[model samples]
Target: MAEKPGLVKTRQERVETRLRQRQVYNERMSKKRRARPRSLNIGDVVLMKNRRPGSKFKTRFESGMWAVTRVKGTLVTVTKGDEVVTRNISCFKRYHGAPADHQESGNNSDHEEGECEFGRVGGTAEHWLASGNLQMGEGLAAQKTTTPGSPVPNQDDVPAEAPAEGSNSEATRRSGLGRYNLRSRLTLPERLRDYVCE
Candidate 1:
Protein backbone atom coordinates (compact mmCIF):
# COMPACT_ATOMS: atom_id res chain seq x y z
CA MET A 1 0.00 0.00 0.00
CA ALA A 2 1.17 3.55 -0.76
CA GLU A 3 1.49 6.07 2.14
CA LYS A 4 -0.51 9.27 2.07
CA PRO A 5 1.81 12.29 1.60
CA GLY A 6 0.45 14.12 4.71
CA LEU A 7 0.50 11.06 7.00
CA VAL A 8 4.32 10.57 6.90
CA LYS A 9 5.04 13.90 8.56
CA THR A 10 2.50 13.20 11.37
CA ARG A 11 4.10 9.79 12.09
CA GLN A 12 7.62 11.29 12.20
CA GLU A 13 6.43 14.11 14.47
CA ARG A 14 4.84 11.64 16.91
CA VAL A 15 8.10 9.64 17.15
CA GLU A 16 10.10 12.84 17.69
CA THR A 17 7.74 13.99 20.46
CA ARG A 18 8.06 10.66 22.30
CA LEU A 19 11.84 10.77 22.04
CA ARG A 20 11.93 14.34 23.33
CA GLN A 21 9.77 13.45 26.35
CA ARG A 22 12.02 10.47 27.18
CA GLN A 23 15.13 12.66 26.86
CA VAL A 24 13.66 15.28 29.19
CA TYR A 25 12.71 12.65 31.81
CA ASN A 26 16.17 11.12 31.68
CA GLU A 27 17.90 14.48 32.03
CA ARG A 28 15.80 15.45 35.04
CA MET A 29 16.58 12.20 36.88
CA SER A 30 20.24 12.19 35.89
CA LYS A 31 20.81 15.70 37.21
CA LYS A 32 20.67 14.52 40.83
CA ARG A 33 22.92 11.49 40.19
CA ARG A 34 25.46 13.68 38.36
CA ALA A 35 26.41 15.46 41.61
CA ARG A 36 27.78 12.18 43.01
CA PRO A 37 28.16 9.84 40.09
CA ARG A 38 28.34 6.14 40.97
CA SER A 39 29.32 4.41 37.80
CA LEU A 40 29.18 0.64 38.21
CA ASN A 41 31.92 -1.52 36.80
CA ILE A 42 31.67 -5.17 35.84
CA GLY A 43 32.48 -7.41 38.86
CA ASP A 44 31.65 -4.56 41.28
CA VAL A 45 29.54 -5.92 44.09
CA VAL A 46 26.48 -3.82 44.97
CA LEU A 47 23.54 -4.03 47.32
CA MET A 48 20.10 -3.72 45.77
CA LYS A 49 17.84 -1.25 47.54
CA ASN A 50 14.84 -2.87 49.15
CA ARG A 51 11.54 -1.13 49.85
CA ARG A 52 10.14 -1.78 53.30
CA PRO A 53 6.77 -3.32 53.89
CA GLY A 54 3.92 -1.29 55.42
CA SER A 55 5.06 -1.42 59.04
CA LYS A 56 6.50 0.77 61.80
CA PHE A 57 10.04 -0.07 60.82
CA LYS A 58 12.67 1.45 58.54
CA THR A 59 15.16 -0.64 56.59
CA ARG A 60 18.85 -0.14 55.84
CA PHE A 61 20.02 1.36 52.54
CA GLU A 62 21.70 -1.84 51.42
CA SER A 63 19.79 -5.10 51.77
CA GLY A 64 21.52 -7.84 49.77
CA MET A 65 24.86 -8.02 47.95
CA TRP A 66 24.62 -8.98 44.30
CA ALA A 67 27.45 -9.27 41.78
CA VAL A 68 27.34 -6.97 38.75
CA THR A 69 27.00 -9.55 35.98
CA ARG A 70 26.14 -7.16 33.15
CA VAL A 71 25.23 -3.56 32.37
CA LYS A 72 23.19 -2.30 29.41
CA GLY A 73 22.13 1.33 29.05
CA THR A 74 20.60 2.32 32.45
CA LEU A 75 19.93 -1.28 33.54
CA VAL A 76 22.19 -3.51 35.66
CA THR A 77 22.06 -7.28 36.02
CA VAL A 78 23.15 -8.91 39.29
CA THR A 79 23.36 -12.48 40.48
CA LYS A 80 23.36 -14.35 43.82
CA GLY A 81 23.76 -18.08 43.30
CA ASP A 82 20.98 -19.23 40.93
CA GLU A 83 19.04 -15.99 41.28
CA VAL A 84 19.69 -13.34 38.59
CA VAL A 85 17.90 -10.00 38.81
CA THR A 86 17.99 -6.90 36.61
CA ARG A 87 17.16 -3.45 37.97
CA ASN A 88 17.64 0.18 37.07
CA ILE A 89 21.00 1.78 38.01
CA SER A 90 19.26 3.85 40.70
CA CYS A 91 18.10 0.71 42.53
CA PHE A 92 21.61 -0.34 43.60
CA LYS A 93 24.35 1.19 45.73
CA ARG A 94 28.09 0.43 45.30
CA TYR A 95 29.21 -1.91 48.09
CA HIS A 96 32.11 -0.26 49.93
CA GLY A 97 33.91 -3.50 50.71
CA ALA A 98 35.42 -6.62 49.23
CA PRO A 99 33.26 -8.30 46.60
CA ALA A 100 31.27 -11.40 47.62
CA ASP A 101 32.96 -13.54 44.97
CA HIS A 102 36.40 -12.42 46.13
CA GLN A 103 35.66 -13.25 49.76
CA GLU A 104 34.29 -16.69 48.81
CA SER A 105 37.43 -17.41 46.78
CA GLY A 106 39.66 -16.51 49.76
CA ASN A 107 37.78 -18.76 52.23
CA ASN A 108 36.87 -21.66 49.91
CA SER A 109 40.19 -23.39 50.61
CA ASP A 110 39.95 -22.98 54.38
CA HIS A 111 36.82 -25.06 54.90
CA GLU A 112 37.10 -28.77 55.63
CA GLU A 113 36.80 -31.05 52.58
CA GLY A 114 33.36 -32.50 53.43
CA GLU A 115 31.80 -29.61 55.36
CA CYS A 116 28.64 -28.08 53.95
CA GLU A 117 29.39 -25.25 51.52
CA PHE A 118 27.25 -22.66 53.27
CA GLY A 119 27.74 -19.44 55.21
CA ARG A 120 30.95 -17.78 56.44
CA VAL A 121 33.31 -18.64 59.32
CA GLY A 122 30.85 -17.76 62.08
CA GLY A 123 27.22 -17.76 60.99
CA THR A 124 23.75 -18.46 62.43
CA ALA A 125 23.95 -22.24 62.04
CA GLU A 126 27.28 -22.44 63.81
CA HIS A 127 26.23 -20.02 66.54
CA TRP A 128 22.98 -21.86 67.23
CA LEU A 129 24.69 -25.23 67.36
CA ALA A 130 27.61 -24.03 69.48
CA SER A 131 25.41 -22.19 71.98
CA GLY A 132 22.91 -25.07 72.22
CA ASN A 133 20.10 -22.65 71.51
CA LEU A 134 17.48 -24.69 69.71
CA GLN A 135 13.93 -25.90 70.16
CA MET A 136 12.83 -28.34 72.88
CA GLY A 137 12.45 -31.43 70.66
CA GLU A 138 15.67 -30.87 68.72
CA GLY A 139 18.80 -31.80 70.66
CA LEU A 140 22.55 -31.28 70.18
CA ALA A 141 22.76 -34.75 68.67
CA ALA A 142 21.08 -33.53 65.45
CA GLN A 143 23.66 -30.74 65.16
CA LYS A 144 26.65 -33.01 65.85
CA THR A 145 25.41 -35.69 63.44
CA THR A 146 26.22 -33.75 60.25
CA THR A 147 30.01 -34.25 60.25
CA PRO A 148 32.47 -33.04 57.60
CA GLY A 149 32.63 -36.28 55.61
CA SER A 150 29.16 -37.79 56.07
CA PRO A 151 26.21 -35.47 55.44
CA VAL A 152 22.68 -36.40 56.43
CA PRO A 153 21.05 -38.65 53.89
CA ASN A 154 18.37 -37.24 51.63
CA GLN A 155 14.75 -38.44 51.41
CA ASP A 156 15.61 -40.70 48.48
CA ASP A 157 18.56 -42.29 50.33
CA VAL A 158 16.61 -43.53 53.35
CA PRO A 159 13.01 -44.73 53.70
CA ALA A 160 10.93 -42.85 56.24
CA GLU A 161 9.79 -46.09 57.91
CA ALA A 162 13.22 -47.74 57.91
CA PRO A 163 15.91 -47.02 60.58
CA ALA A 164 19.45 -45.91 59.67
CA GLU A 165 22.81 -47.52 60.58
CA GLY A 166 23.97 -45.36 63.49
CA SER A 167 22.34 -43.25 66.20
CA ASN A 168 23.70 -40.13 64.45
CA SER A 169 21.97 -41.03 61.18
CA GLU A 170 18.73 -41.78 63.02
CA ALA A 171 18.85 -38.42 64.83
CA THR A 172 19.63 -36.57 61.60
CA ARG A 173 16.80 -38.22 59.69
CA ARG A 174 14.35 -37.63 62.53
CA SER A 175 15.37 -33.99 62.85
CA GLY A 176 14.73 -33.53 59.10
CA LEU A 177 17.60 -33.93 56.64
CA GLY A 178 18.24 -31.65 53.66
CA ARG A 179 16.11 -29.00 55.33
CA TYR A 180 18.48 -26.04 55.35
CA ASN A 181 17.38 -23.18 53.10
CA LEU A 182 20.02 -22.12 50.60
CA ARG A 183 18.75 -18.51 50.62
CA SER A 184 19.66 -18.19 54.29
CA ARG A 185 23.13 -19.55 53.52
CA LEU A 186 24.09 -16.29 51.76
CA THR A 187 27.12 -14.51 53.32
CA LEU A 188 28.54 -11.02 52.87
CA PRO A 189 32.08 -9.75 52.34
CA GLU A 190 34.16 -9.27 55.51
CA ARG A 191 34.62 -5.53 55.02
CA LEU A 192 30.93 -4.98 54.43
CA ARG A 193 29.91 -7.15 57.37
CA ASP A 194 30.78 -4.61 60.09
CA TYR A 195 29.07 -1.76 58.24
CA VAL A 196 25.83 -3.67 57.73
CA CYS A 197 25.73 -4.88 61.33
CA GLU A 198 26.24 -1.35 62.59
Candidate 2:
Protein backbone atom coordinates (compact mmCIF):
# COMPACT_ATOMS: atom_id res chain seq x y z
CA MET A 1 0.00 0.00 0.00
CA ALA A 2 1.34 3.42 -0.99
CA GLU A 3 1.66 5.86 2.03
CA LYS A 4 -0.44 8.98 1.66
CA PRO A 5 1.58 12.25 1.84
CA GLY A 6 0.75 14.55 4.87
CA LEU A 7 -1.64 11.95 6.34
CA VAL A 8 0.88 10.85 9.00
CA LYS A 9 1.91 14.48 9.69
CA THR A 10 -1.70 15.60 10.09
CA ARG A 11 -2.49 12.64 12.34
CA GLN A 12 0.54 13.35 14.53
CA GLU A 13 -0.43 17.03 14.74
CA ARG A 14 -4.03 16.18 15.69
CA VAL A 15 -2.88 13.81 18.47
CA GLU A 16 -0.44 16.42 19.85
CA THR A 17 -3.14 19.10 19.83
CA ARG A 18 -5.57 16.88 21.73
CA LEU A 19 -2.88 16.03 24.30
CA ARG A 20 -2.10 19.73 24.85
CA GLN A 21 -5.77 20.66 25.24
CA ARG A 22 -6.30 17.87 27.78
CA GLN A 23 -3.26 18.96 29.79
CA VAL A 24 -4.50 22.54 29.88
CA TYR A 25 -7.92 21.44 31.02
CA ASN A 26 -6.41 19.25 33.71
CA GLU A 27 -4.18 22.08 34.96
CA ARG A 28 -7.17 24.42 35.27
CA MET A 29 -9.13 21.80 37.19
CA SER A 30 -6.16 21.05 39.48
CA LYS A 31 -5.88 24.74 40.36
CA LYS A 32 -9.55 24.80 41.27
CA ARG A 33 -9.18 21.61 43.36
CA ARG A 34 -6.27 23.23 45.22
CA ALA A 35 -8.42 26.20 46.15
CA ARG A 36 -8.91 26.17 49.95
CA PRO A 37 -12.30 25.37 51.47
CA ARG A 38 -13.69 27.58 54.25
CA SER A 39 -11.73 27.00 57.45
CA LEU A 40 -13.88 26.24 60.51
CA ASN A 41 -12.00 26.26 63.80
CA ILE A 42 -13.29 24.75 67.03
CA GLY A 43 -16.12 26.78 68.58
CA ASP A 44 -17.18 28.21 65.22
CA VAL A 45 -20.94 28.43 64.63
CA VAL A 46 -22.35 26.69 61.59
CA LEU A 47 -25.76 25.97 60.14
CA MET A 48 -26.04 22.39 59.00
CA LYS A 49 -27.46 21.58 55.57
CA ASN A 50 -30.65 19.58 55.92
CA ARG A 51 -30.48 16.74 53.40
CA ARG A 52 -34.14 15.95 53.92
CA PRO A 53 -36.18 17.73 51.26
CA GLY A 54 -38.46 20.18 52.97
CA SER A 55 -41.33 22.17 51.50
CA LYS A 56 -40.31 24.41 48.60
CA PHE A 57 -40.71 27.45 50.84
CA LYS A 58 -38.56 25.98 53.65
CA THR A 59 -34.90 26.93 53.99
CA ARG A 60 -32.09 24.52 53.07
CA PHE A 61 -30.26 24.97 56.36
CA GLU A 62 -31.27 23.35 59.65
CA SER A 63 -33.32 25.39 62.11
CA GLY A 64 -31.10 27.30 64.58
CA MET A 65 -27.28 27.24 64.33
CA TRP A 66 -24.98 24.59 65.75
CA ALA A 67 -21.62 25.19 67.42
CA VAL A 68 -18.61 23.24 66.20
CA THR A 69 -17.22 21.10 68.99
CA ARG A 70 -14.55 19.29 66.98
CA VAL A 71 -13.32 19.36 63.40
CA LYS A 72 -11.42 16.45 61.86
CA GLY A 73 -10.27 16.72 58.29
CA THR A 74 -13.37 17.25 56.14
CA LEU A 75 -15.73 16.31 58.99
CA VAL A 76 -17.23 18.49 61.76
CA THR A 77 -18.93 17.55 65.00
CA VAL A 78 -21.87 19.51 66.36
CA THR A 79 -23.95 19.16 69.52
CA LYS A 80 -27.53 19.96 70.48
CA GLY A 81 -28.38 19.23 74.11
CA ASP A 82 -27.01 15.70 74.59
CA GLU A 83 -27.22 14.72 70.94
CA VAL A 84 -24.04 14.95 68.89
CA VAL A 85 -23.61 14.58 65.13
CA THR A 86 -20.67 14.44 62.79
CA ARG A 87 -21.17 15.72 59.29
CA ASN A 88 -19.06 16.35 56.20
CA ILE A 89 -17.64 19.83 55.72
CA SER A 90 -19.86 20.31 52.66
CA CYS A 91 -22.95 19.79 54.83
CA PHE A 92 -22.43 22.99 56.82
CA LYS A 93 -22.93 26.67 56.03
CA ARG A 94 -20.89 29.18 57.98
CA TYR A 95 -22.83 31.26 60.50
CA HIS A 96 -21.79 34.95 60.54
CA GLY A 97 -23.35 36.29 63.74
CA ALA A 98 -22.79 35.51 67.42
CA PRO A 99 -22.96 31.83 68.39
CA ALA A 100 -25.46 30.19 70.77
CA ASP A 101 -25.04 29.81 74.57
CA HIS A 102 -23.03 26.60 74.10
CA GLN A 103 -20.18 28.60 72.60
CA GLU A 104 -20.20 31.00 75.57
CA SER A 105 -19.09 28.26 77.99
CA GLY A 106 -16.09 27.63 75.77
CA ASN A 107 -15.09 31.29 76.14
CA ASN A 108 -14.29 30.86 79.85
CA SER A 109 -11.98 27.91 79.15
CA ASP A 110 -10.30 29.70 76.24
CA HIS A 111 -7.07 30.31 78.15
CA GLU A 112 -6.84 26.70 79.27
CA GLU A 113 -7.73 25.45 75.82
CA GLY A 114 -5.48 28.01 74.02
CA GLU A 115 -8.22 29.23 71.73
CA CYS A 116 -10.46 32.28 72.14
CA GLU A 117 -14.08 31.52 71.34
CA PHE A 118 -16.96 33.86 70.61
CA GLY A 119 -19.98 34.54 72.92
CA ARG A 120 -20.37 35.68 76.52
CA VAL A 121 -22.05 34.57 79.77
CA GLY A 122 -25.00 36.27 81.43
CA GLY A 123 -23.03 38.38 83.89
CA THR A 124 -23.87 41.34 86.10
CA ALA A 125 -23.51 43.66 83.14
CA GLU A 126 -25.98 41.53 81.19
CA HIS A 127 -28.31 41.43 84.21
CA TRP A 128 -28.28 45.21 84.53
CA LEU A 129 -28.78 45.40 80.79
CA ALA A 130 -31.84 43.10 81.03
CA SER A 131 -33.23 45.11 83.97
CA GLY A 132 -32.68 48.33 81.91
CA ASN A 133 -30.76 49.93 84.78
CA LEU A 134 -27.44 49.91 82.95
CA GLN A 135 -26.57 53.50 82.03
CA MET A 136 -24.26 54.31 79.16
CA GLY A 137 -22.37 57.40 77.89
CA GLU A 138 -20.17 59.82 79.83
CA GLY A 139 -21.64 61.68 82.85
CA LEU A 140 -24.63 59.29 83.05
CA ALA A 141 -23.40 57.78 86.30
CA ALA A 142 -22.04 61.13 87.55
CA GLN A 143 -25.39 62.88 87.12
CA LYS A 144 -27.29 62.21 90.36
CA THR A 145 -30.58 63.60 89.08
CA THR A 146 -32.19 62.89 85.73
CA THR A 147 -33.85 66.33 85.94
CA PRO A 148 -33.62 69.12 88.53
CA GLY A 149 -35.79 67.52 91.25
CA SER A 150 -35.97 63.74 90.63
CA PRO A 151 -32.97 61.62 91.62
CA VAL A 152 -31.85 58.48 89.78
CA PRO A 153 -34.31 56.54 92.00
CA ASN A 154 -31.84 54.63 94.17
CA GLN A 155 -34.73 54.28 96.71
CA ASP A 156 -38.55 54.19 96.60
CA ASP A 157 -40.31 57.17 94.92
CA VAL A 158 -42.48 57.89 98.00
CA PRO A 159 -40.70 58.25 101.34
CA ALA A 160 -41.94 55.98 104.16
CA GLU A 161 -44.24 58.06 106.43
CA ALA A 162 -44.74 57.29 110.16
CA PRO A 163 -47.12 54.41 110.99
CA ALA A 164 -50.87 55.40 110.90
CA GLU A 165 -51.42 54.61 114.60
CA GLY A 166 -49.72 57.49 116.49
CA SER A 167 -50.10 60.53 114.17
CA ASN A 168 -53.45 62.47 114.35
CA SER A 169 -53.03 63.64 110.72
CA GLU A 170 -52.69 60.07 109.47
CA ALA A 171 -55.74 58.99 111.55
CA THR A 172 -57.94 61.84 110.18
CA ARG A 173 -56.83 61.28 106.58
CA ARG A 174 -57.56 57.55 106.89
CA SER A 175 -60.75 57.78 109.04
CA GLY A 176 -62.43 60.48 106.93
CA LEU A 177 -64.22 59.10 103.95
CA GLY A 178 -60.71 59.70 102.52
CA ARG A 179 -60.86 55.91 102.59
CA TYR A 180 -64.38 55.64 101.02
CA ASN A 181 -64.15 58.75 98.74
CA LEU A 182 -61.96 57.34 96.04
CA ARG A 183 -62.64 60.31 93.69
CA SER A 184 -60.21 63.24 93.81
CA ARG A 185 -61.35 66.80 94.86
CA LEU A 186 -60.68 68.16 91.35
CA THR A 187 -63.23 65.68 89.94
CA LEU A 188 -66.04 66.90 92.32
CA PRO A 189 -68.69 68.96 90.45
CA GLU A 190 -69.11 72.63 91.47
CA ARG A 191 -73.00 72.49 91.70
CA LEU A 192 -73.06 69.51 94.15
CA ARG A 193 -73.37 71.62 97.36
CA ASP A 194 -76.98 70.40 98.02
CA TYR A 195 -75.91 66.76 97.42
CA VAL A 196 -72.89 67.14 99.78
CA CYS A 197 -75.17 68.48 102.62
CA GLU A 198 -77.73 65.73 102.04
TM-score of each: 0.34, 0.37
lDDT of each: 0.57, 0.58
Which prediction has the highest TM-score against the true structure? 2
The residue-by-residue lDDT of candidate 2 on 1-198, one tens digit each, is 999886666777999999999999988997988856559867665678878856788778776556677889988997554468899988887665332222234236524444333333322222222333322233333243344223345457758777666455656667655544455544556787457532
Which regions of candidate 1 are displaced past 4 Å?
Answer: 1-38, 99-198
lDDT of 2: 0.58
Task: List model 1 lDDT by residue over 1-198, tens digit each.
Answer: 998787566777999999999999988888866744549866665677776545547455444456677899779998765578998898888755332222334456755765533233333233233333322222223334543334446659886775545544756546544343343456878877766431
Q: In candidate 1, list every pair of residues with a backbone clash.
A: none
lDDT assessment of candidate 1: 0.57
Report clash pairs, candidate 2.
none
Worst lDDT 10-window in candidate 1: 131-140
